[model samples]
Target chain A: MNDISTWDVVRNLLDGVLWTLGLSLTAFVLGGLTGLALLFARIASTAWLRKLAKAYIEVFQGTPLLMQLFIIFFGSSLIGLELSPWLAAALGLTLFTSAYLGEIWRGCVESVPKGQWEASASLALSHFEQMRYVILPQALKIAIAPTVGFSVQVVKGTAVTSIIGFVELTKTGSMLANATYQPFLVFGLVALGYFALCYPLSVFSRRLERSAHGTRAH
Target chain B: MTYAFDFASLLEYRDILLAGTLRTLALTAIGTFFGLALGVLGAASRAWQLAPWNRVFAVYVELIRNTPFLVQLFFIFFGLPSLGVSINEWQASILAMVINLGAYSTEIIRAGIEATPRGQIEAAESLAMTRRQIFLRVVLAPALRKVWPAICSQVVIVMLGSSVCSQIAAEELTFAANFIQSRNFRAFETYFVVTGMYFLLALAIRQLMLRAGDRLIGGRRT
Candidate 1:
C-alpha cells in the first residue's frame, strides 16, 4: 500500500478542475443556444408557443438539478439507451441551464419598452425584423451582464454532475479525500479551485451589472 | 426495444419516500429560519459600517457564494470529525445549508436595507429615536417589505438546493429516490416520482413563503 502525498492530491485535483471547466463550457454553450430559441418561443406572438415555453421552464425550474441528473444518467438506461456520465451530465445541465437562461433572457427582452415594438411595427417591419433590428439589440445590452452572472451558476451547477460519477473537481476531491484521509486539505483545495474559477466571474458580473445600471441610468 | 415502466413498484416504498420528504421539509424549514436570522444580523452589522464586522461579513459572503455547496457540506461532514468536532449528518447538512443561504440572504437583505430612504432615517433621528429603534422601526420593516419577494425566491432556491444534502446520506428526498431505485431496480420511475415530489415541494414552499411574507412584512407603508 502506497501513501498519497499532498502534492499528488493537489495535482490530481487540479486535473479534475480541467474537467469541471470543460463541462461548464459545454453546458453553457449548448444551453445558451437552446435558451435563445426558448426565449423567442416564450415571447412569441402566438399564445401556444409562449405557453409551451413557460411550462417547460416551470418543470425544469421547479425540480432539483440532482434529480434531473439522476434521470439522465440512470433513467436513460432503462429506456435502452446507455449513456456515459459525460453525456448524461451534459444533457441534464443543458436542459437545466436552458430553462434558467431562457427565463433570464425573456425578462430582459420584455424589459424593452412596449413603445419600441409599436414603433418598429409602424415601420412595417416583420416580426423577425422587429426582433433582429430593434428588440434584441436593445435586450442584448441588458442581457449581457446577467448572462455572465449566470455563467457562475452554470459553473457551480456542474458540481452536481459529480454525483453521477463525473470526474469533475468535486468528485475528484471526494476520491482524494478518501484516499488521503485528509478531507480538510483535499476539500479545502477543491473549494479553492472552485473559488478560483467562480470568484473572478462573479466580480466581473458585478462590474457588468454596475455598468449596465450606469448606462441605463444615463 | 420494449421497456415497461413500473411506477407501481415505487408505491411499495412509499413510507421511505414519505419520511424522506418530511425530513427534507424539516431541513428546509430549519435552515430557512436560521438563514434568515443570520442574514438579518449580517445585513445589520454590515449596514452599521463598523469596519471589522463589515469586512468579516463581506469575506464570508464572498467565500460561500463562490464555492459549491457540496464541498461546503463535505468540509463540514468529513473535515470536522477529523478536527475533533464531531457532528451527525443531519446537523452538518442543516449547518451547511444555513451558512450557504445566510450568505446569499445577507447580500439580498443588505441591498434591501441600503435602499432605505435617507430622509426616513433622518426623520426618525429628528424624533430623538435611538439608532437601534430607528433601524428596527424605520428601516427594517420597509426594507423587508421591499425585498420579501427576493428573499422568498432565495428561500426557494435554498430549498431546491437542499436536495444535495442527500449526498451526505441525510435521508432526504433524493436519498429516498436512490434507495427506492436500488430496491426496485426502477431507477427512472423512482427518480421521476421524486422529481415530481420536489417540484410540488418547491411550488408549495414558494406559495407558503410568499403568504407568510404578506402576513409578516406586507401591508406596511412603502
Candidate 2:
C-alpha cells in the first residue's frame, strides 16, 4: 500500500525490529520470573501445586506455539474482548516461554545431586530454607548451560509472532517481498537478521555446555 | 465488547475443518516417515566419517540448523516455481518438511549412534558378523532404542511445524482457521477453536507415540 524504496522498506523493518526485541525481552524477563515460580510450584513440598504446574507445562509444551499465539490473540476477541496485537502476542509468547523456561530450570534443579538434598534435609533446615540456601546454588550451576540453550529456542520461537500480523521482522519481510517481487532478498535479509539475533545465544549455549561438562568431569 | 457469540459459522465449516485436520495428519505422517529415514542415513554417514561426504553432511546440517523454517518453506513454495518446477503447494510443503526433518533427525540419530559404545561393535565383529550385520545388530537397533524418545519429541515438533505450511495455502489446520476468520470476521473465535483442535490433536499424537515407544523400548530406560 505504500510506494517505497528497498532501503525504506528495510529501514521500516529495522524500526520494527526494536518492537520484536522489546517483545522478546519483556517475554523473557516476565516469563523467566513466572517460570521460576512455576519451577518451585512443580517441585516443592505441595503435591497439588506440583500437579497443577505440571499440567500447565504439559498444556503449553504439548500444544504448538502457533496455536498458543492464535488462542490468545484470536480466542479472546471471540468472547467479546478486544486485544491489541502487541498485547496478545506478548501474552501468548509469555505463557509459551514460561512453560519451557520452567522445565529448563526444573532440569537444572534436579541436576543438583540427591545427596545434596538429603544433606540439606538432615541439617534440620526447613524445606524453603534448604532450597533458598543449599540446593539452588548448586542447581544454578548446572542450569546455566541449558538455560542459555533454551534462550536460542526462545528467540526462534518469537518468529511465530509474525503470524499474528505484528509487523515484526518476518512480517516486514513478507510485506516487502510481496511489494518488491524479491522474495529471496527479503527473506534472506530476514533470515540473516534472525541469525544475527540467535547466533550469539547459540554460541553462548555451546560455550556454557562445554564448560559445564568440563566441570562435571572435574 | 458487543460481538455476538456464534457457533453457526463454525458448524457450517465443520466439513472443511475436518478435512483440514485429516490433511494435517497426512502431512505429519509423510514428513515423519521420510524425515526419519533421511536422518538415519545422514547420521550414519556422519558417524562413520565417510571423508568428503562427511563434510558435505556437516554443511547440510549446519545450513538447515541455522535458517528459519519459514524461509525454507518459501524457498520451496515460491522460489521453486521461479526455477521452472511447477509443484503444488502441498507437494512443496512436504518437500520442505522432508528436508527439515532429515536435518534435525540426522543430528539426533547421529548422537544416538555415537553414544553406542565401541565395545558393542567389537563384540559383534568378534562374533564373525559382517560390517552390515554388526551395524544392524549391534549399533542401529540399540541406538534407536536409546534415542527414540528424543526423536519422538522432535517428530512432534515437526508435526506442529506443519501448521506453518498453511501459509502457502495448503489446506491444513491453520489454513482452515484462516478461512473461517476471513469469511466470518471471527479472527478471534476461529483461531481459538483451531488452537483447541491442535491441542487435542497433539495430545492424541503423544498418547499414540507413547504407546508405540513403550512397545519399542520395552522396560528399557529411555
Best by lDDT: 1
Instruction: Provide chain B's TM-score, model 1.
Output: 0.96
- Model 2 Cα lDDT, one tens digit per residue, B1-222: 467767667888998899999999999889988988999889999999988877888878766676668767876776667667798998988998899899989999999899999998888888899998888768887887788877878878888888888888998989998888889887766776787788788878867876786786454465
lDDT of 2 by residue, A73-190 (tens): 7667667578888888888888988999999889888878899889989999998999999988988888887887777667667777888787777788788878877676777677
lDDT of each: 0.92, 0.82
TM-score for all models, in order of appearance: 0.98, 0.91
lDDT of 1 at A190: 96
Q: Please identify model 2 stretches exceeding 4 Å from their true place.
A: A1-13, A78-81, B1-9, B184-189, B213-219
Task: Report interface Cα RMSD per prediction.
Answer: 0.8, 2.3
Runs off by more than 4 Å, candidate 1: B220-222
TM-score (chain B only), all candidates: 0.96, 0.93
**Across residues A1-218, which tens digit of lDDT does each residue of candidate 1 receive?**
54898889989998999999999999999999999999999989899999999999999999899999998888788777899999999999999999999999999999999999999999999999999999999999999999998998999999999999999999999998988888988889999999999999999999999988887546
TM-score of 2: 0.91
Docking class of 2: acceptable
Instruction: Itemize residue pairs with steric clashes in candidate 1.
Output: none
